[model samples]
Every structure is written in C-alpha cells, then in structure tokens.
Target chain A: DAGITQSPRHKVTETGTPVTLRCHQTENHRYMYWYRQDPGHGLRLIHYSYGVKDTDKGEVSDGYSVSRSKTEDFLLTLESATSSQTSVYFCAISDLAGGPDTQYFGPGTRLTVL
Target chain B: AQTVTQSQPEMSVQEAETVTLSCTYDTSENNYYLFWYKQPPSRQMILVIRQEAYKQQNATENRFSVNFQKAAKSFSLKISDSQLGDTAMYFCAFMKHGNYGGSQGNLIFGKGTKLSVKP
Candidate 1:
C-alpha cells in the first residue's frame, strides 16, 4: 500500500488564506510528488522532491510551493488560496529504480475554497 | 515535453467479459515508462500495471495486462474476466527515465477513463 498518508483529508478555507498540505511516507523512497486532480483535466503535477531539502515545480506550479526537509515528509503550500485552487491533492512516492519506477499514491485530500 | 491521451472518457463491460482501454502518448525520448493507475471511488490511486519502453514483452499482473505498441506509441490495458470490483477511473501516465530535476520522475497523466463493470 506504499505506506503513504495525507493529512487533513478534507479542508475548507476562504480566499486569500494560506494553506499547507502534508504528505508522509514510511517506505523511505527517494522520490515524492504532489498532484492535483480536477475534472476534465485529470491529474496535474504541482511539485516533486528527489531528496531531503530538494524540491522543484511541475507543469501547474504557478501558485503552489513545496518543501522537503526529511526523507519521509513532503509538504505543499499555497501562499494564497483561490477558488480555482480547490482540488483533490494526491501525494505519490517512488524508489527510482534502474528500470521503471512505479509510483504509489496516497488517499488524497479534498480542499475547497470559498 | 510529453503528453498522454485516453480517447474513451467512459466505458462499460459485463461481468466475466473482457475489456480493453486505449491510451496513446507522444514522446521523442527513447527511454521512458508507461503506467496505468486505477482510482476507485475510495479516492486511492492504485498502480494496476506498468510497461517499460525498452522491453518488448508486455507486462501482466493477474487479470490485468498491457498491450505495448511502441511504434504506434499506444499502450492499452486489457482486463479479463471483469468484476464489479473492477469499476473505477483508470488513468494513463508517462514518465521519462532520468534525474532531470522536476522533469525527472514526474508523471504526466491523461484525463482518465471511467470503467463500469455491470453484473
């Protein structure tokens, strides 16, 4: 089951408020990723980390930021939430093996902005 | 940049029957990976199967298998003996095989196809 967990399974906040989502993994994998799932768009990558203190943005990282201070924790933060930012956030982990690295996803967090 | 496409937005199959979900991707890199992920109503994304670009042989896991056509850039998932539990939203994803910062190890996914298995 990848041993992945996301905190605040469901959250609601007002516009302009800052929000952070947590993704924790017990597999000790080297790769972690944050993605948002929206209708008609499916899943879009927001940010990912390859190691501790190493992070980078994805295709739709315009308003999202990420931090990875340890091997097991990766956090995604929205400096200012907007109504359009509401989505189901998913955290995935991969070991980056020599061959194909299959990613395992977490339960996902549903966020709503008013 | 690479893009994955799933033509079917929704599909249905009768229990005990077989169904195939089509996925097409565009990539210029020779080294990469393809995967099919299933997201049930529970909201958990599960890895159903994966096929390596270098390997000609298709990947199989129990009732789940993939038809890898590298030339056509087509990867289709075949589910045999479909069951009620097979109903879920299936996603097709692609990832390049390298450590190129954010681009590496990041999966580009398609819109997804909803599969309904009826009894």
Candidate 2:
C-alpha cells in the first residue's frame, strides 16, 4: 500500500448540491492526480496537482475543481453535482523517483448524484 | 494526442493456465511509457507492470510479463500460472516522456478488459 486514503468512501447527493471529496497521502509525493471511473470509459483524469497551489485541468474537468494547499492533501469539489458526475473517483500519487512514473492509488470513493 | 485500446471486453481462463490480454496504443511521440494496472473486486488499483519505450527488452514482474512491440504499437500482458487472485479488470495506460514538471504526467487509459479466473 502507498499510504494513501480517501475520505467519504461513499456518498450520495441530489442534483445541484455541492459535493467535495478529499485525498490524503502520507508519502509526500510530488504529483497527485484525481480520476473518475465509469463503465465503458475506463478511468478519465479529472484534475491533478504537481505541488502545493499548482494545479491543472485534465481530460474531463468540466464539472470539477481541485485545490492543493499542502503536499499531503488534494481536494476535488463538484461545484454543483449532476447525474453525469456519478462515478468512482480515485486519487493517485507519484514521486517520479528516477524510475518509470509509477502511480500508487488510494482506495477510491464512489459518488452518486440523483 | 495518445490513445490506448483494449479490444477484448471480457476473457476467462482456467486456474493454472496462461492467458494473455491485448492492448494497443497510438502515439506519435517516440519516447513514452506503457503500464498495466489491475483493479480487483475490492476496487484497489495495483500496478502490474511497466515498459519504457526506450528499452528494447520487455519488462516482467513475477508471473506477469509484457510483450512490447513498439513498431506495431502493441503492448500485451501475459500471465503465467494464473490464480483466482488474478480475476479482475485490467487497464492499459500510456504516458508520454519528458513531461515531468507539470500537467503532462497524466496518463491516458484504455476502456479495460475484464479477466475472470475460473476454478
């Protein structure tokens, strides 16, 4: 295990509500990523942070936002939940430590919007 | 842009038998990396193996090995002596090289193949 944990392992929220998921890592990795997994779509990147206060949009970042104020924590928030946003969200960390950029993942959070 | 494809939606193999999962990627860049990740029923994503495009030899980790045909844009995972523990959804991903500093470290993934290890 990579010492990564995701809070709120499962969540259900009604449409138009605000939802936030947290990813915490103990490894102090330099890179942290958020991805959403859906049937027939594999895992699509939502957002990622390279360091505290530095973030970038991924392939699917329309309804989501992310912020990292510290090395160990990265947060993903859905400003207004939508039914299409329902999926399993995963957090991953990578050190890029002179080897292949192998990313270790957290347990994941299942979020449903109705 | 890069794209990963896993043609097989589902596959099954008897315990102790060998099975291979197919993955193909399209990339114009010459330097990159390929990886296979396994997601068991518990939904924990585990890195199975990785191959660097610059390396000619395939990469292997215990019972899991990859066949890297760079020219053909193919990367396949072969599991020997498969066990029940191997039953899971396998994903193939691609990452371009030299994007270490910022947003480029993100990975592009395939739809995934479901492997069932039968008793």
Candidate 3:
C-alpha cells in the first residue's frame, strides 16, 4: 500500500547517545507501531500509537520512548543507545476505522550502537 | 500470556519444490488471528497471509497456504512450487482480538524459520 517508510535505512551511533528513528506513513493509518527484530528473538513490539497524541508501550519499551504528534508520523527515541539495542527496527500500520486490520510493515532500519 | 514457537530454526528447499514450516502458538483466547510474515534479505516484513480463527477454511495466497489447526493451536505454512524469492526468514504471529480489531492487542511473534531455497 506504500503506507509506511522508515528513515535512515541504516544507522550507526555511539553508546550513551540519544537517537530518534522516524516512521512516516502516507496512507494516514491511525494505528502505527515500532518493533525490533533480533536473532533468536524474532520481532518484539517497542511501542504503538492508536491515534494522534495517543500512544502506549509494548513488551520491549524499556529503553525506548515514542511520540505520535501527528497521525502520519511515529517517532521512536532511544534515550541512551546501547549495544543491546542494536537490531533491525520495523514500523507497521493498521487501519483504525474498523474491520479486520491487517498490519503493513516498512522496510526497516538497521541500527548499530558502537 | 500468548507465545508463538517455531522449533525449526532453519530449513532448506530446492527450487520448484515444496516445503512446510511449522509454527505452534499458546493462547487462552478462542477468538484471534494468525499471520505469516516473510522477511527477505532486504529486511522488509511482508504480510504473506492471515487467517481468522472464526473461519474454518485456511488462508491461501497463490502457492503459499496454511494448515491452521485451531484445536491444537498449530499454524503451519505450506509453500507449493517454491520459488527462489521465497528464501527468507518466515515468522508466525498471533493476535488476540482486543477492544476493536486488536486496537488494544499486539502481534505476538515466534522466533522464526530461516528457509533456504536452493536453485
């Protein structure tokens, strides 16, 4: 659907530094999510937003924070980057209007914490 | 808590052949959804297919299909006439129906099966 796109397809940052990854959607989906995929752990949800200014944490939201100032964007922030946080991050979307909402994913952002 | 398990860490299949990836999930809820996502080397999570628990018929997309045994909590994916492009990391996911179309639920995913389709 060409709904979502994650910026900085790849990123490398030093430890303890803060980094923010952006997820932009064109389809105007009300539901947006952030997930991290690591070897042996599959994909773990970091956070999700159901509407503008309405967001909630997921299973792996400890080291991350999310913001949804607008419906088209959901930003994931790493307060202090760590090697353990290095993984491929994926952004997903779902229609909130109703019905069975199938989640669509973005290409992903490979983050490297040095 | 819901959990998804994929015992097979990896598998291999010859081109134009057939292969099956096994996935089992544990969920207390009776109504939910099951999904299969494919991630190629490009690292994009593509929605391969999805099945609603209320539906008796399994979900199928072209050569890709599923054997959803709701009673046994098993959702296995079958790839017929597998192509080289099918080589990728396949994930089995589960979602329990929440307040509204899973508005309050998150997709619980299994470790994954890395399928290697050889030519």
Best candidate per lDDT, number? 2
**Which prediction has the highest DockQ against the true structure?**
2
Interface RMSD of 3: 2.1
Off by over 4 Å in 1: A97-99
Candidate 3: give the clashing pairs.
Answer: none
C-alpha lDDT of candidate 3 relative to the true structure: 0.90
DockQ, cand. 1: 0.74
DockQ of each: 0.74, 0.80, 0.65
If the candidates were sorted by their lDDT against the true structure, best first, what order would they fall in? Answer: 2, 1, 3
Residue-wise lDDT of candidate 1 within B20-99, one digit each (tens)? Answer: 99999999999888999999999899989988899999999999999999999999999999999999999999989876
lDDT tens digits, residue span A1-114, model 2: 799999999999999999999999999899999999999999999999989999999999998999999999999999999999999999999987837677889999999999
Docking class of 2: high
RMSD of 3: 1.4
All candidates in order of TM-score, best leading: 2, 1, 3
Error of 1 at A40 (Å): 1.0
Query: Given candidate 1, what's the lDDT at residue B66?
Result: 95
Q: Which residue pairs in model 2 clash with each other?
A: none
**Cα shift from native, residue B46, model 2 (Å):** 0.4
TM-score for chain B considered on its own, for each of the candidates: 0.97, 0.98, 0.96
What lDDT does each candidate get? 0.92, 0.94, 0.90
